[model samples]
Target: MTLAVLSGVGVLAFAGFVYSGVYDVGADNAHTRPVLSLLQTMRERSIASRAEKLTLPPLHDPARIRQGAGNYNAMCTGCHLAPGVAETELSKGLYPTPPNLTREQVDPREAFWAIKHGIKASGMPAWGKSMKDDYIWNMVAFLQQLPSLDAAKYHEMVEKSGGHSHGGGESGAGHHHGGEPMEHDDADHADEAQEHSEHTEPASPSTVPEHGKPGHHH
Candidate 1:
């Protein structure tokens, strides 16, 4: 009888708290220390648990890292600032500032999983929807080396990567937009296509939605 009464009161208190609308939900309002700690712990445990299940691929390949440089520069720089960049307008306005990848190194498994399936409510987008697993891993490869790179070296690597290639027909190959089929002529991009084929089968070209554009927030 006592347990049931306590439970009922607890439920009522929670309901009242919800209805009060006293807690601020605005991004400008920062969470209390306790709440922030709880959230950080929850996020870390969740990522660690899920990341344990992923089988890591070889992430030290030079070609893969080079490919990743271009994608990272084009996609991630706005949010996760690069070696020379301190911050951007987008990064500044984000509720939780995105990590500077140029200063931090993440575990390959965690990086791949987060890149593939983005964190909930965070600015991170699930790249897997528009990108293949192999391409995501390529980004992971670059991340492992990111912390060691200075501005000059990072630019050089990106330049050699040919810039913003998704490695799965989303690069220079025209996308399937406006009901048009993507045209990939082997004669035109024979070398590029061949290089991409070495990693994974070519994915049919599809337009990435505005929200699904490749970028990592964590």
Candidate 2:
């Protein structure tokens, strides 16, 4: 009788998970704790499983780091926020707010794969489809060293690599107001700082919105 009751419970729970429309697909809705935890676990496990067999070529050239920094600054820094760099107003309001790459949790291969293929349902998009293989690999090489880098180093690398980022919406690709760039009235990096505390999550090491157009820079 007890076995039968447990089986019934399992069936009902599975059915509930499948039939329930409670899962919010919107970019606006913050994930519930259980849902967020599931996603996080899935992300870690999937990366670990897949990255194990992937062999990475030696990528120690300083030029590669410079090149990757260019891509990161112009494309990723606004959302991901480089070491010691601050966030923008647009990045602040985003649900799941972008991750800080300098934190201890990020792994090298995971960073590479995340850049190349991008994450699904979150804002990360696959750069492999849009960017060339060499560029993607360069970014990977740079990410391997991101944790040890300080804010000054981050700025220097990007600037040396030819990534001169201007404030305002000009640097990014996607837009809510049609294809045209959306205008934010308060345009300083200081204004960008305002959105930091608004974030709902404690923010894991590195994150991008499931939808905010990760990887591909305009």
Runs in model 2 with CA error above 4 Å? 1-29, 164-218
What lDDT score belongs to each candidate, Candidate 1 first? 0.70, 0.61
lDDT of 1 at 37: 90
* TM-score of every prediction relative to native: 0.75, 0.63
lDDT of 1 by residue, 1-218 (tens): 69999999999998998899987767777887887899889988999999999898888899999877767765677688777767765677776677888898798898888888988877887878778888788889999998998877876777676555564435433222111222345564565555545644332322211222234122
Tens digit of per-residue lDDT, candidate 2, span 88-207: 544676667777676655666776678777887767767666666677777777777888888777655655664422222221223121111233344533443444335432112122
Cα error, residue 121 of model 1, in Å, equals 1.2
